[model samples]
Target: MRVRVLRVLDVGGLPRVFWWVWVSTLVARTGAFVAPFLSYYLTRSLGHSAAFAGFVAALNAGGAAVSAVVGGVLADRVGRRGTLLGALVASAVTLVALGSVHSVGLIAVLAFLAGLANNATRPATGAIIADIVPSGDRGRAYALNYWAINLGFAVAMLSAGAVASHGYSLLFMGDAIANVGCAVVVFFTVPETRPTSVGVAGAGHAGQPERAGTLVDVLRDRIFLGFLGAVLVGAVIYSQAQTVQPIMMGQDGLGPGAYGAVAALNGILIGVLQLPMTSWMRRYTHGSVLAASSFLMGAGFAVPLLISAVGHPMGVYAGSVVVWTIAEIGSTPPQMALGADLAPAHLRGRYQGMSTLAWSVAGIVGPLVGGWALTAIGASAVLWASLLLGAAGVPAWVMLDRRSRTRVATLRAAEAHWEPVLSAIASPEVVSAGVPTSEPEPEPV
Candidate 1:
């Protein structure tokens, strides 16, 4: 049992840089009190209506979506280390400024700026992980990062309620302080890892020069576009937990306490199980894992329909939460690793940014759609709708996985075809330099 526990905690092969990144991520997320309580602060403390608070929230999400793409471009252009430092520092300033503001307009503006800065860091961080960690270990690295995030969130959620009771200013100040600390950590520890280009003419096909492409270039990649679509669908399906589930439960006679308990259970399960499950899932292809996760999430959400037949058994709801939480644990790390794997060395930041964009877009669209569906067709239909969406996404992800495999195979074939020509070009220079000719090393399997 002790050995098994040790195995789960083992993160030995990943780079030292990743551990520091994980630490900073944990610190930042743990102190994230402002965003969670932003709606409450507007509605209760500032005496704004819930509708206004929601509008401000929507602005934040929209800013995040735009900033993610912009940040990705900046990370590739300026450097990951600098971009991350800028994002953290900007977020800290915004958070501090947000506390001092009383006008709803100013508060909303600061919230959007804060969201932009905070979300901008995500793609840069992801790109850095891909830059530093070996391809084979990326899944584990991302899993460990995800685990840290959930752990921080668990801590933050617990402390947020207590902090809110004190004042919204304290929450904003605390969050700002944490962001500053994260910035300091990155400034000191994380170095720039962006690949340097040798120039288009000098570098051959195998060693193509790294260059930042326009957003149109990213949009043109059909495989990536398909993957993004699948991700957007999955996010919308999973999002029902936040927007629709509680309402349904409340309508069925469940209290806030019951809903909070289930939500907490989801967080706890992911925090505890994500790393171990990620390690175990390394043996499977991304497609299989994603398909299974999508189906599980859909099935879990669909279980609410069974509640009507079961005479409103709470056990059915609880069981569904468990299933979906497990699915969450299974899906995140593999999906991130796959994104990194599919990205070119130069385009990693952009690819990750695009992936983040899918989630951000879903954050905006999902609640609106789910809320509308809930009112228009009722809860049961909404749940079934979520299930159908998940089912549709499974095939898209499966196709993405197949495309990724095909691309890897094509690259390998190209490398094999170019080997002899490269050797022929180099042989005369080698002879002139008095170096003995030998077989070239084989490419990584």
Candidate 2:
């Protein structure tokens, strides 16, 4: 057992994999930190409104949504490492352009472009991991992957806040620097995942036949589609908190330091606890674990609604954050693993890209909805809306549970159908090699 464990890690040493993923995430997410207080920066610093913040955020989301599919298709065709490198370089160039621009319209366009590049990194990086790691180890791989992303963003966020306190120019400078660093590391260190067509054909595995399907055929698979719907709703609610929570907590009297502290807590929790959570939850079906955790994540978002004290809501928010953080640790790895499972040998890049798109859709809607809720009703209304959306997510999760079961059954049936042919071939090879082929005498009927 120990030997098997050592062998798997040796196949891709955790440290080596960790460094590549960590640096990539740090660079990509650091650019993301450029937008840390963007809504506030735009409104308070550049003289905009809550409405303008939503518009800019929505524009970014739209860019991400479109790019998700485009990125996936490109990753499938171009290779994951190249796609990632391209996005990073593009992001860096665009951020430099953004720093030079003064017009809101141009900034909006630049923000969308930056968002396109930023969101594209997700699927490309994810597909690379899928290519390198064994199926059984994917859960831990993704856990570590998520940790890298969050930790990088956590540090970037703190730095961005500090930089912005000095000036927007400094923030942009920092963001651009990080993105350049990201591109450089990825260019030098990360190897391209072997092209799908060549690798699958070379292996001549039976699973190769199923890899012939295009993106449409893969997306149309009923079981996979159902899981996508569940994730879409959960993502929408979960993403809103990124913008909405800051506004609500700011109203509750927390300053930048408090906000940074909470964000750090989130990062620290995932970094420290994610591996243990993956190890402990390995026995559960991916769908069951993801759905349950989604429910918990939604519930955690709802918890802040009960706080009335502007002075004390930070504590309430922190405790609730811990709950959701735990849920995040549980749900994220299984969610990523199941997504990779949905594609066969050839379509891993596209499917993973589509998953990023699914999240992008949420990213687009989440903040806009929060802004609308706060404008029409109040800040508290946003929390209530989150509760409703979260409740709706439960049934979608139930559907995911059913769909996951069906997918497993289908894979089993396919395997069982092919086993006899495989056994016959194996038996012949054994006999040809002068080995006992496990022949059994026929009994009288």
Candidate 3:
């Protein structure tokens, strides 16, 4: 096991700049103090209703949806490093500003702005990894980056729970500091990774004249759009972890501390198991993995209802957490890798941004729906309904997997030019994305 783990990490020979960027990601996520607990703060400490918190959270998501497009454009145009650094600084400033406001109306607006700033860096971040890491290593590179995110999240949840008692302001202030730290690291260490395809749209590969792509062109892609639909559903299920899950626990009389501990299990499990399981996860098809994730998440969130029926303690919500954590481990790395596969080299940021858009959009829809359902139908019914949504999403993904593989095959059949991104997809065990239409070949230097 140890040897396998070592090979995965060492084979990448991930550059020093990559580690610096990874460290920055860990720092930023570790300081993401307020997001996980925001709904809780609104509902419990501020004496707001679940529905109102959902509205506020939705507003935040709305801002993130807006940022997703702008950030992607900026990353490809100006450069990844600059866009990322700017976003980090803005995120920090917004967080500090958010800490001082007391009026609910003002709070909602600031939350929106914070979401914008906080999420804007995502496309740039993904672009940087692709720009830096070799094709064969990008999958494991993404996995390692994910591990950092969860590791940071584990520490944040633990610390956030402890300090939560002293006043949410402290949490906000700490988060701001962390954002500043992330920005500083980026400015100093992470370099610009925007492809040379900056000016001319779809001209050629990375080293040639810089190309640009319109958001319209990217949106027109039927295959990517279909995948986005699946991602949107998965993102909704995923979003429940922070917003609805805690709201449900609060409904059941569990406090921040207990919810914190239970939630920590998610980050903890991913941090520990994601790397070790990456090799195993590579053995499956993308559609199968995504479909399985959707089902597991639906069932996981509904576990509380089953446990309750069996007279189990509601506190054992850990059962639900475990199932979904497994799903998360299975889905995230491949989901990212596959997006890279589907995109043309020039439109990488916009493509990635659209993926972020799905999550941001899910954030908007999931909370409002989850909140309304919790109020009207009750938490159990709302959760169990997730299973139905998952069931609906499964077939679409299966068909999508087939169609996408076919698309790649068609692209390869022609004397089409190969992009570095596509090369990675053709590697042994084919871990990255874009299923190989023919036998694997060594990527050209």
Candidate 4:
């Protein structure tokens, strides 16, 4: 039993730098107390309406959307390490400042800035994972990193209520400290993953030199854009738990502690079940897994409608959380892998940034609409809408899957285009970091 557990948890074969990145992600996510609770803080602490809270949360996500473009461009132009480090430091400063202020205008402005600074690190982080982990294990590597994120979230959720009870100052301060920890890890341990010489990093077919991509170039990709559209749909469904769940629970007479417990359940279930679920899901194609996840998430979000009939709020909420967490696990790894599979190495940062942008856009839309619906229309209405929205994406995913076989092959070849570049440029300071760089080598059968 112990051996089985070890086998499931072990990550010894990946590059050492990946561990540093994992550590940074773990430390950072463990302190993700602010964003999740921001809506609660607005309603309960600051005496704002749920609609206003949604607006602010949407505004924050808007900042993330803008940063997605800038951060991706910077990651490619400037370098991943520097962009990540600068973003983290800025995030820490912005988080602290946002926590210190009291004015409504200041809160909105700072929330936007905080979103920009905090989320700008994502493209760099995803690009780094793409850079270091071998091709065959990329899916599993992403799953492992996601596990670390959920594990940390579970830890944070466990203490968020207790800490918030002490004061939200402590919550923001703790979150800032965690950002600093992430920066320290990155500055010392995680090396630059983007190739210094553009020619060495992303040489193309027939000895042709590849050019740097513009946002236009990335947008020109119709298939990828369609995939992003699909991503936007799922992200909207996921964001409801953040934006509307608190308000729903609050109206139902559940406090922050109850919400925290419910949120914590999501993290715990994901931390425990993500890997095994991801492992089991390997047999399925990405389209099918994502399609099923969509339905599950829709069902999970709609479960809150059963509140009055169920009579046990926490039990119903916990059950809902379990369903949603499973949906999250099913969707995340494949989504990450497919995103990686679709982009060229040269535009990885931009591609990841665009992926993040989809989520950010969803963040803006989900809360803006969900919060309004919760306050104006009804919570049941908002949730039911999410189910329909999720269902709309199934055909899109299925169509994309049918078209993706050729694109994936092209992508694999593109990545292989970087192998000689990676081998030639490898060093302690440069990219690749000793992990196998290409997807051509078949995994052991």
Candidate 5:
């Protein structure tokens, strides 16, 4: 058992920079008290309606979406280190300011700004990992990062209730302090990792002209766009655990404590099993793992239908949580790694930012849709809808995998087609004839 644990935790051969990033992430997430309890703070502490609370949350999500794009551009242009440092500092300030506001309108505005600052760091962080870690080690690196996030989140959730009982101000202040600490770590340890123009040119597709790294380039990538759509759907389905699941459970007579326990189970399961699962999943393709993840997530939510029918709703709900937690564990690392893998060196930050944008959009859309579905269709329909959405991702990923393989094959063929010409140009005889003698560059694999 000890040996197994050691093997699971052994993310060897990664750079020292990656470990510091992991550490900073863990610290930041551990102090992320506001997001988990945002709704409660609004509805209970701030004397707002549930609808108003939802609106504020949506505003925050919108801010995050917008900032993700901006952050990506900044990371690419200004450098990853600077973008991350600015984001952390800005987030810390906003969080502290948020702790003092009284007016609802002001609070909403502050929440948006806070979210913008908080989420702006994501793309830079992801880009740095992709920049430093080799492709083969990326899955483990991302998995370890995920593990750190869950571990921190578990600690946050466990402590949040106790802290909130005193005053919500403490929660915001704690989060602010943590964000500042994260910034300090980045300032002292993390370095700028954005690739230079020459490096970008060398790492791009061979035989294709170098293009500027921009949103236009990302939007033109059909395979990545499809993957992003699928990510949106999956994010919506996953979002229900926070938005709809607890409400439905409450209506079914489960107490808030029960919901809290179930949510805690999610964090604990991910924290415990993610590393081992990542190790095991290394044998599978990203598509296969994602496909299984989608199915499990759908099935987990759908299982409640059967269990509720049999009058054992709580038991079934717990079981469903287990299933979906496993799915989350399986899907997240590979999905993150795939984004890094698919991106060119120059556009890595933007690609990761686009992925973050998908989740942010889902954050806005999921609750609104889930709430309407619950009101218009009923709980069962909502579950079925979640199931369908999860199932839909399976085909999207399969298609993405197909398209990616086709692109790689095409690139390889292009390389083959260009090789002889390049060789001939590089030959001494050709050089003597005044032709250039540069070696052929291989396209990014």
Candidate 6:
């Protein structure tokens, strides 16, 4: 089915924002390509074992999880552009620092800091896109951004392997350079999005000051929490690609080059196919889309279990890549879009941040479980764990789907019931943190 090109620039002057988002996604992902190889470098070059590598990687993921939430809050309070700029610069510095470290302990600490900085920009980026793009066009914008990110990742992963063949140090240095270069571009090009009264920051004024919303206010919304729960389930499975797959494959005789190739394949599918997939999926209910995609993703993860030894290991690993890519095409963008959808008009950053936080936690924890499974049981168990998590997502996804639909229904009833109340709250505009003061009190006759 052919989809019309929905433009994201109804408000005007947003082309530059889109360009910056595209470039930033590319550059950030290029730097991110080095992440998958970190464990390999530590274990193979520095002589650490898989378990030790898992611990180190876990620390980085843990840091990223913490920073993601903090980044969201700061972006809502400060501005998206500034928050993104800071995160990009910090990540670049940390990646460079990571290259300089030789001690195992030091590397772990640096890795955590790097992950934190790397992930912190997520909410800010999402918020910026929400701020600039019209709602109708936001999905396409996000899909395109997702494509740029995956494209860069694919290139980076392939390049990392080739560069690492020369020297692992070279890969790290290259990633840092790309990160810094991207940061510079973002600092100049990405406009700051301020919070608006409705919860969207910088909706009208780019530099206008907005009061931040209380965490309590953001959390109390049942719809937002429901969306966050769904995201967390998906994130747990997604992190396996970065932290678990390499270790599992290594045990089965697949080397970094092969693993990187798999990553490259995953990237290609996402970059090339995600928009098309999202376009088709957008017509469906978001809940159904998420549930179907989650199952596919889980199926992809399970397929890798068949391969044991190197040299393709029964060809299942290669096949699994295709399956996983298909699942990713179904899963990732919709998840981002859903999070954006659930956030109140003004509070995209907080909600996006919370989603990132869930991902961060999953990133930290998934590998720990996979690592233990690999150490204690075998690679097969890792697949089992992924499958279980994927299966577990079904009930929550159903709950969220029901809840989301109901919220839309209830919004109408609430609007009618509290029409007067809402008016009073909006009168005089009690602005805090750039967000609108609160819901209005019913108006007096």
Cα lDDT tens digits, model 1, 182-220, are 887776666665553212211225454434456677788
Candidate 3 lDDT over residue span 1-445, tens digit each: 8777577644246666677778999999898888877888888878889988878877887889999988887776666777788899899888888878878888899999999998999988987776656444566777788888888877787788778778888888999999999987776666554544222224443235444467888889999999998888888877788778888787777887888688677777886788877766667777788778778877877777865567544546888899988988877877786776677656777888898888888877887778788888887788778788777777877888898997645433321343343333323333222121233111111
Better of 3 and 5 by TM-score: 5
lDDT of each: 0.78, 0.69, 0.74, 0.80, 0.80, 0.69
Model 6, 1-445: lDDT tens digits are 1222432212222344576678878876776656778888888998989988878877887888888778887777666666788888888788888878998778888988988888888998887776555444566677778788778877776677678889888877888788778877775565445434333222223334433355676679877787777777777787788767777778677787888677667766676677667667667766787787777777778887655454456367778778777777766666776677666545667878888888777766666666677788877777887787777777777778787765544433422333233233223332112232333211111
How many times do residue backbones clash in model 3? 8
lDDT rank order? 4, 5, 1, 3, 2, 6
What lDDT score is found at residue 149 in candidate 6? 79
Better of 1 and 3 by TM-score: 1
User: What TM-score goes with each of the models?
Assistant: 0.89, 0.80, 0.82, 0.85, 0.88, 0.77
Worst 10 residues of 2 by lDDT: 436-445
List, residue by residue over 392-437, the lDDT tens digit for candidate 2.
7667766776666655455434434443433332232322342222
Local error of candidate 1 at residue 178 (angstroms)? 0.9
Candidate 2 has what TM-score?
A: 0.80
- Give the best candidate by TM-score: 1
lDDT accuracy of residue 60 in candidate 3:
83
The TM-score of candidate 4 is: 0.85
List model 5 lDDT by residue over 1-445, tens digit each: 8766567666665676788889999999989999878888888887889989878887888889999888887777766777899999999999998889988889899989988999999999998887767666788899999899889888888888898889999999999999999988777666555654223342344546654557888899988898888788888888889878888889888998899789888988887788778888988888888888987888777777885568876787898899999989888888898888778666777888999999999888888899899999999999898788788888888878777776544534433433343333323343233211222222231
**Under the 3 Å rule for N, CA and C atoms, how many clashes does model 2 have?**
0
lDDT of 4 by residue, 1-445 (tens): 8777756765546676777889999999999999988988888988989988878887787889999988887887777777899999999998898889878999999999999999999899988888766566677778888998888887887789899999988888999999999998887777666743334435446366545666777899998998999888899899988769788888888898899788878777876787777777877888888888888888888888898787887788788888888889988878887887787776778899999889888877787788878889987888898788778778878888888879888767766766555434334444234332322211111
Against the correct fold, how does model 3 do in TM-score? 0.82
